[model samples]
Target: MLSDKSRPIIQATLPAVGAHIEEIAKCFYGLLFAAHPELMDGLFNRSHQADATQQQALAGSVAAFATALVNSPDRLPENLLSRIAHKHTSLGIQPEQYQIVHDHLMSAIAEVLGDAVTPDVAAAWDEVYWLMAYTLTHVERGLYGARGVSPQTVWRQWEVEKKIQETDDVVTFVVKRIEDHLVKPSLPGQYISVQVPLPDGTRQSRQYSLSRADQGDSRQFSVKRVHGAAGKPDGEASTLLHTNVSVGDVLTLSVPFGPLVLDDYSGRSMVFISAGIGITPMAGMLSHLATTGSALPIMLLHADHNENAFALRDQIRDDIVALRHASIYVWYEQGADSKLPVQGVFAGKMDLSHVRLPDNAVYHMCGPVPFMHSIRSALIALGIPPRDIQYEMFGPDLWQADYE
Candidate 1:
C-alpha cells in the first residue's frame, strides 16, 4: 500500500509522468546499458531492444503500477506482477539488479522531466518503484525456491535429440539432459528460456513454450523463425537454432517458468484457443491431459493460414482423440482441407458463434495481440467473465496495461 503522504502526490502527478513515461524509459535503458553492457550479453533480448518493444513495455508497466497504487491502495495487481515474476525468474534476474534499475530509472526520470521533478515528487515515485520492485523480488524468490534452484543454478546444458521441421517457418527440437540428471517437470503451458551462443561470440536468449508433456529426462519446444519485416533485424537466436543447431548440438536451457499453467481448471471444461505459432503451449496442455487420462471436457479452437501452416496438427488431433470427451475445431483463412473429416472445419477468420461453447469453460488463448483481443471481446459478449480468459504473450508484454 502507498503511504498517505505519497498517494496524493502520485495521484496528482500521474498524468504528467504518464505523458512522458516512454521518454523516461528510453533514457533509462540508455543509461543502464551504457553502465552495464554485460546485461546485454545474455540477459536481455537484443531483438526486442532494437525494436523498442522492451522500452514500450517498461513505460507501460511503470505507469500502470503507479496508477494502480493510487487507485487501489489496498490491492496489488496480481496478473501484472505474476507475469513479470515468471519472466524474470526464467531469465535468472536477481534481487540486487532491482536497485541498479531503480538508480538508472530515477536518473532517467530526473533527466527527462527536468525542473518539473521536485524532490517531493521524486520521493513519491521512488516509493512506488521500490514497492513494485520489492514485491517482484519477493515473488521471484518464491518462484526460485519452489523450483529448487537459485538464479545462478537455474541453467543446464541439454543435447538436442531430434529436430523436426513442422512448417515452412516452424521447427520443433527435442532435447535431453546431458549428465543424466533428473530434470524438474514442467507444467502444461509453461515455457523455458534457451540461451544460444551466436557465431559472433555473444549469447542471446529466447523463451519457447514446451510443446509436449514432459518426459523424465527430456523436453520438447517449438520455435518459429522470426522473419523480420522491412528495416528490422531477423531473430538471431531462432535463426541460429534453425540453421546451425543439430541433433548432437548442446544448448543452455532455463527451468520452466510461466504463469499460464492449468492448475485451477481441474474440474471445468478447458478451451484451448490459438493461432499462428501460439499453438505450442496449447499442444503441451493437451498432451499432458491426454497422458494423465483426464476425462474433463475439452475444446480446441485454432486458427491458421491453412492446413499446411498448422503445426502439431496431427499430434494435437491424436491427443484430443485420446481424451474421452474432447472436440477439435479449426479455422483456415487461406485454404481448406477438402478430404479431411467433415465435422469442425471452417473457412475465413475465426467466429465463435460458429461453434458451441461448453458450460463452465475456461478459455486459454495465445496469438497475435489483435487476434487475442478479438477473441477476448467475443468471449465477453458471450457472457464469459474476463477473469475466465487467460492469454500468453510471445514477446515483451506490452498489452497488459490495456487489459487492466
Candidate 2:
C-alpha cells in the first residue's frame, strides 16, 4: 500500500507524468543502454527497441500501475504482473537489475520533467517505482523458486537432435540436454528462451513455445523466420537460427517459464484458438490432452494464410485424431484446395456464427493482437465472460494498454 502522503502527490501529478511517459521511457532506455551496453547482447529485444514497442510498453505499464494505485489502492494488477514476471524469469532477469532500471528511470524522469520535478514530486514518484519494482521482484522470486533455480542459473546448453521443416518459413528443432540428465519438465503451453550467438559475437535471445508435451528428456520448439517487410531489417535471432543452426549444434536455452499452462481439464469443455505462429502453445496443450487420453470435449480453431502456410499441420491433425472427443475448424484467407485432406475447413476469415460454442468452456487464444482482439470481442458478444478468456502474446504486451 502507498503511504497516505505520497498518494495525493501521485494523484495530483499523474496527468503531467502520463502525458510525458513515453518520452521518459525513451530517455530511460537511452541512458540505461549507454551505461550498460551489454544488456543488448542477450537481455533486451533489439527489434522492440528499434521499433519503440518496448519503450511504449514500459511507459504504458508505469502509467497503468500508477493509475491503479490511485484509483484502486486495495488491489493490484495480478494479470499484468504475472505476465511480466514470467517473461522476466524466462530471460533470467535478476533482482539487482531492478535497481539499475530504477536509477536510470528516475534520472530520465528528472531530465524529461525539468524543473517540475521538485524533491517532493521526485520522492512521490520514487515511491511508486519502488512499489512496482518490489512487487515484481517478489513475483519473480517465486517463479524462480518454483523452477528450483536462481535467475543467473536458469540457463542450460542443449544439443539440437533434429530439425523438421514445418512450413516454408517455419522449422521445428528437437533439442536434448547435453548432460544426459532428466530435464526439468514443463507443462503444456509453457515456453523456453533460446539464446544464440550472432555473427557479431553478441548473443541474442528469443522465446519460443514448447511445441510438444513434456516427454521427460527432450523438447521441441518451432521457429518461424521473420522476414523483414516494408523496409525493416530481418529478425536477428530468427535469421541466425534458420540460416546457420543445424542438427548436432549446441544452443543456450533457459528453463521453461510461462504461465499459460492447462492445469485442469477434468469435465469442462475447452476451446483452443490460434493464428500464425501462435499455434505452437496450443499444439503443446493438444499434444498433452491427446497423449493423456483426456475425454473432455475439445474444439481446435485456427487461422492461416493458406493450407501451405499452416505450421505443424500434420501434427495437429494426428493429435486431434488421438483425442477421444475433439473437433477442428480452420480458416484460410487464400482458400484451401478442394481436394485437401482436412474436413470442414472454411475459406476467408473466421466466422463463429455457424460454429457451436460449447457451454462452460474455457477459451485459450493466441495470435496477432488484432486477431485475438476480434476473437475475444466475438467471444464476449457470445456470452463468454472476460475472465474465462486467456491469451498469450509473442512480443511486448502493447494490447493491455489499448484494451484496458
Candidate 3:
C-alpha cells in the first residue's frame, strides 16, 4: 500500500508523469544500457527495444500502477502484476536488478521533469517504485521456489536432436539434454526460453511454447520464420534459428515457465481456439489429453491463411482422433486446398454464428491481439464469463493493460 502522505502527491502529479512517461522510459533505457551493456546481450529482447515496445510497456505499467494506487489503495492489481511477474521469472530476473533499474529510472524521471520534481514529489514516486518492485520481487521469489530452482541456475544446455519442417515457415526442434540427464518436467501449455548466439557475438533470447506433452527426457517447440513487413527488420532470433540452427547444434534453454497450463478438465467441457503459430500451446494441451485418455468433451478451433500455412496440422488431427470426445473446426482466409477431403471448414474470416458453442465450457485462446479480442468479445456475447476466457500472448504484452 502507498503511504497516506504520498497518495495526495501522486494524485497531483500523475497527469504530468503520465503525459511524459514515454520520454522518461526512453531516457531510462538509454542510461541503463550505457551503464550495464551486458543486459542487451542476453537479458533483454533487442527487437522490442528497436521498436520501442519495451519502453512503452514499462511506461504504461508504471502509470497504471500509480493510477490504481491512487484510485483504490486497498486493492492490488493482480492482473498487471501477474503478467509482469510471469515474464520476469521466465527471463530469470533477479531482485537486485530492480535497484539498478530504479537508479536509472529515477534519474530519468528527474532529468525529464527538471525543476518540477520537488523532494516531496520525488519521495512519493520513489515510494511508488519500491512498492511495485518489492511486490514483484516477492512474487518472483515464490515462482522460483515453486519451480525448485534459484534464479541464476535456471538455464540448461540442450542439443537439437532433430529439426522437422512443419510448414514452409515453421520448423519444430526435438531437443534433449547434452549429457545423459533427466529433463525437468513441464506442464502442458508451458513455454521455454531459447537463447541463440547471433553473428554479432551477442546472444538473443526468445520463448517458444512446448508443442507436445512432456516426454521425460526430450521436448518439442516450433519456431516460425518471421518475415518483416511494413519496412521493419526481420526478427533476429527467428531468422538465426531458421537458417543456421541444425540438428546436433547446442542451444541454451531456460526451465519451462508459463502460467497457461491445463491442469483440470475432468467433468467440464473445453474450448481451444488459436491462430497461426499460436496453436503450439494448444497442441501441447491436446497431446496431453490424448495421452491421458481424457473423455471430456473438447472442441479444437484454429484459423490460418490456408492449409499450407498450418503448423503441426497432422499431429493435431492425430491427437484429436485419439481423444474419445473431440471435434475440430478450422477457418482459412485464403481458402483451404480443394484437393483436401476435410469437411465443414469455414471460408474467409472466423465466424462462430453458425457453430453451436458448448455450454459451461472453459475457453483458452492464443493468437494475434486483434484475433483474440474479436473472439473474446464474441464469446462474452454468447454468455461465456470473462473469467472463463484465458489467453496467451507471444511477445511484449502491449494490449493487456487496455484489454483488462
Candidate 4:
C-alpha cells in the first residue's frame, strides 16, 4: 500500500518512463550492480555488461511496463502486455524476479523523481506494477504449465568440440560435451548459450538457434555475426567466434530452450520473415520443414543490406525450388538486379507494410527490435491472430505489447 501523495508521480512519470524506459532501466542496473556486486556471477554477463547496447533492450522493456502501469486506469494495450510477457518469457524471467525488479525500480524512480514524489503516486504505481506483474505471471505460469517445466528448468553450458563456417559470417558449432551430458535432448528452434571470453577477459553468452529440430547426440548451432550497432559493427562474441574460438575450445552451454520452435506449427502455412542475421533460425526451420515433407506455402521472406550480406540466400532459393509450396522473397537493401521471386525486393528498407501477409499463416519472425515492432504491428493490423504469429527479438523478449 503506497501513500496517497505518491499516486500522481507514479502516473505522471510512467508514460515518460515507458517512452524512455531504457534510460531508467540503465539507472536501475547501475544501482543493482553497484550495490550488489555479488549478483553478477549468476545474473550479469560480463561481456554483455561491457556492451551497453546489449542490455538496453531488457531494461527498456522493464521500464515500458512501469510506464504502462501508471496508466492502468485504462487497460493496457493487449499487444503491449503480451509482447512484454513474451520478452520476459524468452529470457526465462520469473515472477520472483519481477518482485525484485519492482522493489528496486520503485526505489530508483523515487530517487529519480526526488522531492516531487508522494505516497499516493507510489501506491498507484505499486498497484499498477503488481497488476501488470499479475498479467505476465499468469501468462508465464500457463506457458510453463503447458511445457510442464519449472523456471530455469533448462539452462546449462557446453564445450565446443568442433566448429566450421557455413559462410563467411555464419558458423556452425558442434557441442560434444556439456555438464553431465555428453549427449542431451534439445528441441529444434531451441538455442544453446555460447560463452566467449571478450578482449577484456570477461565472458558472455549468446543464444544460437540449433540448425536441426531433433533431440540427438550431435547437436549443432549456427550463429550469424551481428554488426551495425551504435558501438561496433561486429559483436565481440561473434567476432571472437569467427576470428578466434576454435575446435576443442570449451564454451559454457545451457540446456537448449526457446519459445520459438518448429512444433505447435503443424499443418499451417509457415511464413518465415527474417532480416539480416535474423535468418539463422529460418534456415533451420526451412531445412527441417523440407525434410519433414510438410512445406506449406513456406514463404521465406529475407531482407539483407546488399547482395553480399545475404546469408544462406542461395540455399533458401535452392531449397525453395526443390520443395513444393516454398519460395524466397529476397530484398537487398542496397539494390538487386537479379530477377528473383522478389515480392518487392527494393534496395531500400524492408518494412512489413508492403507485403500482403498471407492469411492463416503460422508466422516465425526475427529481426532488430524496430524491425520486429514494424512487422508485428502490421501483422496485427492485417488481422492475423496472435497465436498464428511468433517472433524472437535480438536482445530481449519485450513482446509484452505483442500478445498472442
Residue 121 error, candidate 4, Å: 3.1
List pairs with backbone clashes in candidate 1: none
TM-score of each: 0.97, 0.97, 0.95, 0.75
What is the TM-score (0 to 1) of candidate 4?
A: 0.75
lDDT of 4 by residue, 161-278 (tens): 6686666678777766556633345554656556566766566667777765442455667778766566645576777787787787776655555667776355767788888878
Q: What is the lDDT of residue 31 in candidate 1?
A: 99
Model 2 agreement with the true structure over 1-404: per-residue lDDT tens digits: 78899999999999999999999999999999999999999999989999999999899889889999999877677787788899999999999999999999999999999999999999999999999999999999999998988987889899899899999899999998787433578889999999989888888889999999866678899999998989999898998898899999999999998978886545889999999999999999999998889989999888999988889889888998888789888889996553334446888888887588999999999999999999999999999998788899898888882236
True lDDT of residue 292, candidate 2: 89
Query: What's model 3's TM-score?
Result: 0.95
Leading candidate by lDDT: 1
Model 4 ranges with Cα > 4 A deviation: 1-23, 45-100, 130-153, 177-188, 199-201, 227-234, 263-266, 306-308, 314-322, 334-358, 373-388, 397-404
Q: lDDT by residue for model 1 over 1-404, one digit each (tens)?
A: 89989999999999999999999999999999999999988899878888899999999888888888888766667888899999999999999999999999999999999998999999999999999999999999999998988998889899999999999999999999887544679999999999989888888989999999988788999999998899677888999999999999999999999999985346989999999899999999999999999999888899999988999887887898788988888899987563333258889999999899999889899999999989998998899998889999999898883345
What is the per-residue lDDT of model 3 for residues 119-220, given as tens digits with 9 covering 90 to 100? 999999999999999999999899888887778877888889989999999999999877543356888998989988999899988999999987767889
Model 1 stretches astray by more than 4 angstroms: 180-182, 338-342, 401-403
Candidate 2, residue 145: lDDT: 91
lDDT of 1 at 41: 84
